[model samples]
Target: MKILVVDDEPDVRTLFEQRFRREIRSGEFSFSFAYSGEEALTFLTGHHSEVVLILSDINMPGMSGLELLRHVKHDLIPPPPPLVMMITAYGDTDSYNQAMELGANDFLTKPVDFTALKDKLHAISTA
Candidate 1:
């Protein structure tokens, strides 16, 4: 599956690359990283069809992930939209509620549990 990861932290790219190295090498999953919501949207504009899932952090520098989520859930599509999972360090109820309202498929808190994340990814891929 092709997945887009959006976060402001540059290190997130490396972290995801390292954590999912085995899956990446096995060709089970391919990732595209964007350091901000705007970048993610730009990438999606040209490659929406290629993406199956999006993992986005809620607190970004420019366009917040919630805004991005609203756009993805409402604006893009040929029918079935890509699944979006919101990530955050806060894990606050307000953010979680907002994300859900915006049509997020899942919610994950940081420091992400790679083991659990892998399982979720496997489930999505298999399903």
Candidate 2:
């Protein structure tokens, strides 16, 4: 499975790489990183079909994750729309509701629980 992780934090790339090393090495999963929502949108413009899932941070400098989600769910028309999961340090009701309304498949609190994320991924793959 191919997943795009969008976050402003540089360390998130290293953390995801380390946590999913086994899956990556075994060819079970592949990942791409985008530092901002605009960057992720640019990547999706060309590679949307290749991406199966998106893990995005809700708060960003410009074009927030909810905006991205809206664009992905409304503008990008793939045969099957890629699943989007929102992650945020501020796990508040407003953010969660907004994300869901924007068509986010899941919402996760930071610091992310790799175990839960892995299980969700596995379930998605199997389904």
Best by lDDT: 1
Clashing pairs in 1: none
Per-residue lDDT for 25 in model 1?
Answer: 100
Off by over 4 Å in 1: none
Candidate 1 per-residue lDDT, tens place, 1-127, comes to: 9999999998998999999999999999999999988899889989999999999999998899999999898987664679999999999999999999999999999999999999999999999
Off by over 4 Å in 2: none
Best by TM-score: 1
lDDT of 2 by residue, 8-116 (tens): 9999989999999999998888999999999998999899999999999999999899899998999886656799999999999999999999899999999899999
Cα lDDT listed for each candidate? 0.94, 0.93
What TM-score should be assigned to candidate 1?
Answer: 0.97
RMSD of each: 0.8, 0.9
